[model samples]
Target chain A: MGTIENILIIGGGGMVGQKLAHALAREPLTPGTTSALTLMDLGFPPGSPAGARQITADVSDPAPLRAALAERPAVIFHFAAIVSGQAEADFDLGWAVNHMAFWHFLEAVRQEHLASGGSYCPRVVFTSSIAVFGGPYPEVIDDGFPPAPLTSYGAQKAACELMLADFSRKGFLDGIAIRLPTICVRPGKPNKAASGFFSGIIREPLNGQEAVLPVGTDVRHWHASPASAVGFLRHAARLDTAPLGQRRALNLPGVSCTVEEQIEALRAVAGNDVVALIKPQPDPVIESIVAGWPRNFAPERALALGFRADADFRAIIESYIREDLAPEQAQRLRLR
Target chain B: MGTIENILIIGGGGMVGQKLAHALAREPLTPGTTSALTLMDLGFPPGSPAGARQITADVSDPAPLRAALAERPAVIFHFAAIVSGQAEADFDLGWAVNHMAFWHFLEAVRQEHLASGGSYCPRVVFTSSIAVFGGPYPEVIDDGFPPAPLTSYGAQKAACELMLADFSRKGFLDGIAIRLPTICVRPGKPNKAASGFFSGIIREPLNGQEAVLPVGTDVRHWHASPASAVGFLRHAARLDTAPLGQRRALNLPGVSCTVEEQIEALRAVAGNDVVALIKPQPDPVIESIVAGWPRNFAPERALALGFRADADFRAIIESYIREDLAPEQAQRLRLR
Candidate 1:
């Protein structure tokens, strides 16, 4: 038997992290090798993927994270961050969790690498966001577009990407920052993120609940299914980084559609009742924030690197239904 | 008279800082307004500009920086950094000084702002660099081009820009990061930066000393004179940041020229005897590093905001001869 690869998911309790953990549990990161999984977070939600060892700890405190790094995991998926709205509202906490903690984590990894006689470089997959690009954006943000983050959350993420790329360049650890699109059909309840309604408009309606669409139906955004996000993480871990060549941050592929198109897709999947659940309530605050977001991308580098996106907006909704729809929600949908 | 504007130059011992300090001593950042200047660095060279208070301290330690912030300087010109070559060689020192210190400094400013009942918002001018970009670049890198720093130094500078922009966005401080082109014809002995030869090729020959031309004459690079660098810092400090909006980082203008052009310009300014002093001795290490540097920029925003560049490469060379040529070197050139 081949050696078992130890894996660490830093924000493993979050939606994407849990999905990644479950995916890894089902199949090893590498096809032929067995792997052990460890998840770290402030706390895991109930019924988080079982069997994976959990380390309940705040990223704001570095002590616990340092202990986690001691194990020398082969692949470390770093997803810990304060979401956009919270980061914007609470600058200190955002900088603490999103920027400072990541700096400490990288340093800890470097310490581990140095202690191991320079042979313990791990694959670090950091989930950066499209928020890194501010408005006055191109019609299609190409690979060459600079990151002008409009929000503190974005600035923090962009800062992390810079560190990751530099550390990787210096050979401390192999790192790839995948600038993820808004994850649509995000499972569970809506959070305080200004972009949360992108998922809420879909998730809430599918669960037989009313959803608030704060911006206009004309509002367009880039999106990927939660499954694609997991796939991007895995691909980043296994892929050869040679092609990335210094520019380690990548804009991932996603479906670009207006809220109107999204509504049509929801109607196509779950009928008029589900579509009817979406209420258009124009919010000036969300409108201003959304205005600064990127509507589409020409993620040529990511696509060339074999990262795939959902086929279309319809396919995106279908993936959510297939992968995340709860039994009660499914029953409720059938009754409608 | 208006209230005296308190100014703090964090890297006041360095070349650009000293130039800025001298300029501030001569006049004021805002014409007709009295201003007080304080310089901070590890140490200052002999004969630094008079009339300004000097604080000798390493930026790696936050305690001293916090103490400096206690004074609540109204305008902070942050230039403290481990230069590119040193930063690349010493990873720990580079990140500590270049990235972490800046974070602590920003936080310290925030603390002061909070302590002052939210009234202390200082104008922060950060000296960033063109190194924030890497190769595979466009003919003229526009304002939209993202920073993909090929060196640890570049990454550190880019990270600082992010933090500064974020802090400014949150109204914690009014910040602007000006990405200066390579400062050419640097006075004193040549340093270890890969681009040192850019200045050495010009400065040494003018001083009647032999200098090596490591790369081919076809190599083009962006450059600004030391005087222009000070100008940029001062302009950034006084410029109304409203036009900057959320994107606080600006790409300053610079002279772009090839080595062949630089040599021709030197011949025009001096004579064949001086130009002949430049010998061709290829160094692969420097050649490789130089190849990744940006060659030109279309800094539209900065130009629109009234930040000017040297008229041409000839003007850049003249600025150095006028401001930095030592008396002994001038006598040597006269003898030649």
Candidate 2:
């Protein structure tokens, strides 16, 4: 009876949030205590899984957090924020949603603990990004590298990371933040993030549409499938974090490959037809933004601590195909 | 009349603030346009410098900041924070003064810019500390090391550092945060900071009174004179921060030495009799706090950028004697 029973997903309408929700529903956390899920977002996601009491709430407001913590949920997955492009474009909204909301949520949790006479320390699994790193960096960035985020999105995430560590150290909450690599073959419509093209190029071509290749194919970057990303969240939720000490954020492991290598891997899986779908179009705006993004990371700590990703880009593509796309859609995709 | 007509020192009541105020008074910023100084704190410091218009108010409240910025100060020296020991003692005040207050201050500056048709970007020089580092083991921490602050004070500083970088990147201010080393042989009577012994042990013994050495003589740490600290602020106020790119904070250079090394330096400068006045009595509270403090840092950035410190521990002691001790006290210290 003493386990994670009441779970809350703050950004349950988002892609990662929905996946995390499904993963949790598939395998109940700690088996005995996890019985109910409270999924909250700006709006209820279409066709969410059963047993979750879905809530449409703007978490940027303190009310949602106040209500969510009133349930005294055993675990909280905080993944809400405007994306990178939006954050940089709209400064005040970025500060409100990305930084202020997150800080207030933590403070609310701390206040709840104080209200409880120092008893509650909920496990908080946060989704951080490689955006926390900016370039003119070493070829292989590591755990020790201080965050020098060049974008508003990266800066917001990095600031949150620091607060997470502090909140945990002070014993207000048990938190673990995983800095994710780019999620390739993302199953969604294209959005404004500079990294959106990494997925769009692959996702569009597979669906029999032409894809724009904005940066040069020689550009090297890091990637993981959506499945691997959800796996990291799951692992982070349950793993013993005392080994993490005061450094609360771990750089999740991923497959490092150039765009040429990615296209080659796609070719190996789907042959020449898929390769032909990509149109070479250099975009300086996207290219400049992507240029400052971190190329690769040596995520030794996350790797040693048992978090794993797709071994190669081929495996990543395969995982996407197996998880996404209908049988008819898949057959058509293979031939197109 | 054209360059920097007015300036603001946010923490002018503090030790470094007072020193920086005096330093500025000695040399006009931009040679002609620096005409006035607005010194603000919780209470006015004793005998503020000439031409400094004094203020007494809580900076955690936005009213003082609004009033301060009404002067349209061209240079803003942000050095007002609750010190480490006090921050740890009061959690809410720490977050409010050390983190939230600093954040609000930045936002206020940003708002002022937005109100000015997007042109006002004041030079913001923040006084950060090596307390941002908490150690397991790294004999020489360098520019690349991520902060893992073990104390609430350090955490607050680290978080503020991240925000400083973000604010500067977003073009809100031309911000530069320099992590100052522990100032050795501080002039004033001792306070409650864990680092107080670093100054007290030397200052008291030189004043012909026995000083308590709370930890082992082998405990190593970094040091700079109060003068050098003020010099860092002066230099940082005018340094070309464009070269810093996305990373806004720097590890200011300092002399690194052990307590035993300090004792040897004291002996060299003031002879064996002065060194003998240090009495060893371990205080676990201070010892444990000091244990987590960083021993050394390789600050290649500040050194290359023309910041400097006392040449050696002997020089640090001599500087303290020259600046801090009275003429009679100095003669008595030399004889003793």
Candidate 3:
């Protein structure tokens, strides 16, 4: 509780983890000194450590992670998940990584807490997704919405959320579930994720490459910046949970926009030349996946707790340019 | 399908089962026909049933139920549970009866469907409860509300609902979850159910005996009559599930009233002479349990589907008199 000196990030090599580790290192925490941290991912941080210990370990097989947890970290951020496309393609792997591993992680925490005479329950902040809300929606969603997940991935996350709530209520672990919107302007190379295209059309085009917009421009979605997502995790780990009472899982706030609006924002920030770098190539698979997702949510609970998102879609684009793009990247207008 | 000529009722000697059996017999679903009906309970039925098949079988041990189900029942009413109070008190029994047996039942149905090649997945009407909804609510609950069950019993029921939804979606079982409100005006000796006093106060006093009114009279509750509950099960079994689509569970509507209102209705029915039989006894354990229950629900979906309940408390009392009590017993009321 005091400064979160010794921290462990389970599944810490992912996109979200990398940002959160950097954020925690830069923040001024309590206890008057920056705390020591351990970042354990399936892969090590690319360069050197950023003021913390780095370990590469597989979480599904817990022998190594259990050893790491023995260090008795003050907080644990669990972000490990098989992306929706991969999980839907491979059922066994989905069960292993997303479903079964979650139970293993929880049992590990339970044992650690009991061993400490109920005095050492670390704060666990789990990253769930908006995919947990399936269709038959009211156009705008709420956190109280029942999770009638259409895919195996959503079902597993919903099940894990249930376990977290149960274990926390039983006083075994201090748990929080933050249902994150799809992170917009994700600064990375295009991946095979079904949701990857949400960022790809924007990110790839911003870098002067024509990216295919697979779904129609009318499709609306809920989004958060990678920075905002990392902030959400930090706040979830540190927020006063007593006010939440029994409502452990909260829907994190996000920006709701149609794809056309996203394109407009990109045009405003990077010029019409950058926007023209996008091409429409419809894919039914992507359209089907996107159609099932929630477009908007009234996250009153999380907003009341001071969680926030980008002021506008334009700001989201500007943040990407300021953070991800090189200074010398040229567009048609700039070349003239 | 096909007139539901053969029916099977599991746990058919418990309070709910006995009432259902009496209702079914009185109605004579297929009069003077050789349509075999089976009722399986852990205990034997009260009277010798030469015509109806009564088997003493534990549902958790699938062998007996499997054998009974092989008779090709067209419909199954599963009303078995170690009630909330008992289930919460004993963890092992709770898992055995409430959680584990449900999976066994579903698996059995899956096998039945596989063997019959989609010819005979019996319509399963499970009596789920308002216990499924936990706190952090508005004035009225809705069907789409996320189930944040606060107790082990509620969790088990929610798990069953999820499993049932999965099975129905997979085409393994024709399933529906009817979340009944607490069945009020229960006509039996008081037992250990935490919600029992809700019924005991009015029911026992109606029979000219003192009944302990634990907790305050102002506490509000949602209620349905046993007869209406039976009708819910029967209708739910036969309803068109196509509109239900992927969401197989239905939250049945009920009458929400304050304890004082309930007493007032009882006074109207049996006059102040019978009301004097009620004694106020404050009990904290009962109060705590009652506090967590949902007091009202806006069952818009259920209402649109044509389900009905008593128009008022007076109608509910009258239904009990005309249906549950004998003529002589009704005459003893003297139309006060």
Candidate 4:
């Protein structure tokens, strides 16, 4: 049964949204029926797939959300927000975009559902982050670890997760907030996120260019390919949330390894020459910010729910090289 | 230098709020300076003391909040919300009052602080509840227990607690959310709260009236006298919140006892005539609700921060008798 038809992806201008859009375009929500996608962001996503209508608007404003709710899209993919470093630097903007926008969006959904005689609740896929967890210890943070967000961004995400559970429990909406691991080898120009280096080191080197390595080689963190993140969202959408109990958010499964382990995996796949393209440059700001983040997770609940991740850093690198990089550019880095 | 002067108590018509209003009216927030009190509720509270100016309005509404904020009260006690049973029965009303209203109030506070040239954040003491914990078996819930509220009321309180922590961290307001225990031997009326029977069984029996005892006598739960609850709020308002990092809410100290234990205490104080007044009339609805509630708490953080509660069930009963009932009523209850 193809339950999903109409789709709405907030923050569609971003990397994960773009990739998710591609995946959904390749496979219809209900095998045979192509899902019409409404993609809303601060800027219209470049090269968005067919059947996707792009809307440019500030997500914090409830007006656009109200208009979108009028169409009654069956599913909503909410990935819109200010990243951690930016949120910490600029508090108000972060609250407006990350917290206030989502609150307003949910309120709009509730209003519409009420107006429809209580039958217009849409399934919402909220992309949370591992930044939502921070602490004094635990080498492997399990699914049950309490969320004690150290940053404003994490706090906002945690708050949103609570709302998702409450709203879903009330039958106002069907929703899941998935805490995504730090996306490794993110294919893009580096932005302002403190965890940006997690991708930049892999991405820049893979592109036959120099990449900075901040912090120590021993720093361990969780990672997943872009494809896996999208897969987690899709799987969560079709999930039987009845078993979720009071916690609506789940820490999605991911590959957990230190930077040294990541480098070795790169060497095995792309050879030592490609790995050597990385340069060492310590940056305190990035180190401190990333240090407070949760190192790894035991995502037991998510794995039980059929969520998956890349087998290893090698698999993650291969996927990025195959999917994100140009073949000619990838071949040059291999030193075969 | 005294930091507190003017005061505002939302939900002032409620028992705890009324008691709080009386306490503030009797003593100054800052010694030698009488702090003016503004009491807001759905209806004007009776006998709310001389300094309190009662405003009959919805506490969740932003208009009255804005009007109150203009005065820049040094301390604000937010004790407003739909009780558990009512919230469960009326979902929409609960969301409106519990969630939306608090959201708007926070926004209003943020706006006021912004408009004040970054100097108008007040000490906000929000009375949260133990309903925030719905466990799958942990003998004693601790300060670090993750909030997984089972009911709509609990969900609302937990969400608000997160917001309080976030807003406080952002320097928007100085806030602390204290999760109060079930107020036992409650004065006046029996409300719709599922845990009201914890009070009803104790109150009615002492008043020489028949009391219905729902659920088994073995069901252990946390309890506090009205005086202790007020003490917690006062201590929270006056305490330096700098020690409380990201987690702003604390479970206030309370006496943990079972219904059988409570009955024994009632007999010791008011004699067998009063103890015999409790008749077992089990209601599955109330039984199930109370069963899901947390049995006891390890309020390590609150106790360490100097928050106190009654030593035992006898102390709780004695405090209620001494503070709430008239002298004639107390004498009659002692005889009974």
Candidate 5:
């Protein structure tokens, strides 16, 4: 295993990317040793590490990315992607950033590795998603889902996975793609993601605001906490892929729960007053998107590898309260 | 159902394409009527119907194909493809012919239909193959089997299926892809296809010549007669895809049999003398290719739609002798 002396996090400005960077900064890397970290985004935000080098360059452009990659970092977390909802809306932009950008990066790494043969190849951990699944599914999906993606975004991701597999098979780069479930209680204001409402209802209520729940109380989905998502990425980066052999992509396991269960968890933590903040509103667009998504996935292979999920919805709510909210806000849930 | 008054056969000079052209010509179209045919290929073979037209052009170049498609024939049979073995061996050729060429054609058709306000959408019947399936399979594969294609050819075909589905969904064109089983008792000289030896062992032995069976006797595979394959394409073109609705691709059924069963059919047809002419020569290259293919597929969807395979191995051999060989050659099957 190569020492991850200097790791670079691409798309660092995004919520998940930023959280991952923060988590890594707090991690104690292999006792009695340390490594420099380089974080890149369109712009550097507050709370980033002191003296941490930051670069402003579009990850979609190959020239600038090649320059970033020139640092020859031991680990690269490629978290850059146009989200599913946005990708579906803008076909051209989605193709450029989501698909072509990934291909260009992989090709660059391949050419570099060929030119400079050595003992170490950079580890590339990519974030795939459960959006890759579509409707007409079994109650639980498995590794062999035919990738009959209903939307262009899912197709693009599936296409990227194929390219990554072929490139890895050609022995160019050590690539790992983790198909993350919908991240619950995302620590931010609401975004355009249709599924964002799933987190919105819970997050907004905790922030003392009312939020709309677009679907019925019966709608269920698979979810992972931001911490678990970051853990999934780091574990994927460090795991021995030899056992995985030919299969480089994985469907990371997650907690599956219904809307009713989520609301119950919210009440358990923040009391009935907080739970009352959620109002049911039906939107066909959001319902269609949610409907097509797999409610749960039995990721047999990923589970076998020991990746964990939120213990329960209550644990998930507690995580948001403990890890994200301020001390004063945490005290609101102290009784629980 | 629309009547196939004027039929256009693209890539007409190819093996399957030519065979299909002849079969259509030899069969009756509708009562007291015949199709006005147009054959398009890179190089048109010598043939002239006083009215039938021929166009010579490269499919990769959209100019000629677009000009030809301007006529808006009622039915289009697309049998054009670079075979799997050749495609896997050459990357550029594979992408250009198998992938890009079809995209250009689809775009052209989409533009035409959109311009005409859907008044002039021609039914497209494209031929696909069983090479789309890969290893790690169950004893009886089903329609739900994921397309984890092992070769670039399979990937291209899978990609085409996606494009076809998208185009059909958008109402740009009416399309149907028939994933054909490997045609057994293929009547011709040996070719480069890895699966060619499967047919070669039977076809050559029936002709009173020695043939090599490169794979072991236990190797099982799905097969259909050349006649059945033609019927599949024709039926697909005329079938009402309205019920197939949106899900435009169908996996045509095929008879599943082991190599030993195939040899037994040949013996049953031409007696011990012909069977004695067979030689066993294990080849790892062919073995590996055959191993990745799906030996059987439970095509309930296709069967429900009225597509049928050869009833048995004996019937497959009998059809080959009766339909492909001369009367004198058919009479030589003394055991029958």
Candidate 6:
């Protein structure tokens, strides 16, 4: 190995973080480089990927974050945040964890840079979200569209993006904020996120369970699979940020489709029996929340910068089935 | 008099704040309602407006802000911030005052709202600036343009706008962040702001003093007068925010003109001798900084909402002469 690259993943216990951790364990961040990984979060799932040191700590407190910065990791992936639902429900917690913690973390990074005579700038990849965009949107949200976030979660994310860009501009760190679309077919039980049903309708049925469709079938949204999310994160880590100029935040490419199209893709992959498991239950609360979401995007910048999305919505379903479905679930699909 | 409506102006010592205070002392926020004004800042300028109580306090500490919020002022004008040049020079102080202090203030407001059983939402009028915008802009930046700030000051303002909007959405406060264009023909000595020369080239020359022009006359910029800034603040305090919806921040209208046009306006009003004091001595530092600023804007929302601007560039200069020129300065202009 040419060199040992130390990588840190905050929120490493989260789904996307674990997937990224596993991918990094399987391959080096760069050719001829051996990577050392450290994962930090409030807690980790059972049997998280091996070969990475895990630290259970709350980011809301700056002590642990400052301690972690002492090691001066070569690459830092900051994915730690309260989910949209929790953030909306608990305003104080959302601002403290999602926004304040990030600010403290950035300030710590700046201290490290200054202590090292400005040579310790690390590559920081932050996971911003599509919640950053609100409604009255253009048919296709282009790269130039402003972030008018309607939710506290989105407002926090957008604030982080601004700070990250400023810190990067001041040469404190090399940073990129990728606004990930809703990760579809999330691998796990349903959570309380208002957008959770987008994944529930697809993931639950594939596991031979009933799922609730909260909004109308015509309700459209932007989505990417967990696998594509990993790809975007890795690509962001290695991206030459020179092309991004001062606009460090990006609207990443994603598959945009309606709930009906998502159901059709699910049916095409798993057959009519699995599709029958989905039941319509109109949820006005979720409907109003989802209405503020962006249904489509023209993420020209990310595409041109070589960030790829799923081939199609059908491909999204296949990726989930291949990667997240349990052996028993896979067997049932095969037998069908 | 009708019921006394308590109003608080942060940064009350500053030019625009004093202008606003003077205006408020002269007239009530709403007819048929008596207005009681309170001004808070680190220090006040000599001869501040009468009939308003003054408090000396540092916003960097949350105690003073909390104490202020305890009174539950009906209208709050948050205009306090570190100027761009100073903010760019001192990163820590910039984030501390411009961003973090505002965060704490908002939190305090939320606390007051909760304490009052959700009945104490104040009308918060924040003085955001065109500095929130950066270059690579459209020919005419519309209301929908994203805030991609190239400076730490701009980024800080943008972050504050996000917090203000989110808080307003949660009904903790009824806030409006008006992105004020660069205030021109400022009636005072020039400060360290990179955009200072935009005012200096006019203010100094009109006062029978030589002014250094750092950039080319061809460099265009968007501007409003100090009088208009006060107007924007008062209008924001009285306007119905329901029409603003979720996007509580607005790009207020302004006059767009180049330095040459500004000089010509001066020559038209006073003769060539007064305009002759503007010396063309290009400074690259200010030039580079000003280059990233927005040149023009199409603030349709603000215009539609009845937020007006100076009729033209000549009108901007004329307003300064009419409102801010000292008797001695007026005498020199009359003789010219």
Best by lDDT: 6
Q: Give DockQ per model, in order.
A: 0.87, 0.70, 0.33, 0.54, 0.34, 0.92
**TM-score to true structure, per model:** 0.96, 0.96, 0.83, 0.92, 0.87, 0.98
The TM-score, computed over Cα atoms with residue i paired to residue i, of candidate 5 is 0.87
> Model 6: which residue pairs collide?
none
Winning candidate number (DockQ): 6
lDDT of the structure predicted as candidate 5: 0.78
Q: What TM-score does the A-chain of candidate 1 achieve?
A: 0.98
Q: Encode model 6's per-residue lDDT on A1-336: one tens digit a residue.
A: 378889999999999999999999888788788778899999999877677989899987778888888899989999999999999999999999999999999999999999999999999999999999998888998988889899999999999999999999999999999999999889997776899999999989999899999899999899999999999999999999999999999999999999999999988889999999999999999999999999999999999999999999999999998899999999999999
lDDT digits (tens) for residues A1-336 of candidate 5: 434477878887778877777777777334443556777777766887654567777887778778777778777888878887887777556756876677688877766776677444788888877766667888888788767777666766766676576566556778888899888889877776778988998998887789999899999899898888888987887887777765677999888999999999898778898888898889889898888888888889998987888888888778888778767656665644
Q: How are the candidates ranked when ordered by DockQ, highest leading? A: 6, 1, 2, 4, 5, 3
Two-way TM-score contest, 4 vs 6, winner: 6
Give the lDDT of residue A31 in candidate 2. Answer: 62
Worst 10 residues of 6 chain A by lDDT: A60-69
Worst 10 residues of 4 chain B by lDDT: B1-10
Q: Write candidate 2's Cα lDDT for A36-71 as tens digits.
A: 788889986586779888888888778867988988
Q: Model 3 in CAPRI terms: which quality?
A: acceptable
Highest TM-score: give the candidate number.
Answer: 6
Pick out the ten consecutive residues of candidate 1 chain B with the lowest summed lDDT: B327-336
Least lDDT summed over 10 consecutive residues: which range in candidate 1 chain A? A42-51
User: Considering summed lDDT, which 10 consecutive residues are worst modelled in model 4 chain A?
Assistant: A28-37
Q: Is the docking of candidate 2 incorrect, acceptable, medium or high quality?
A: medium
Candidate 5 at residue A186, lDDT?
91
Collision pairs in model 1 = A146-B146
lDDT of model 4 at position A292: 88
Off by over 4 Å in 2: A1-4, A32-34, A334-336, B1-4, B32-34, B271-273, B334-336
lDDT of 2 at B57: 81
**Which 10-residue window in model 5 chain B sums to the lowest lDDT?**
B44-53
Q: Fnat per model, in the order given?
A: 0.98, 0.74, 0.29, 0.45, 0.24, 0.98
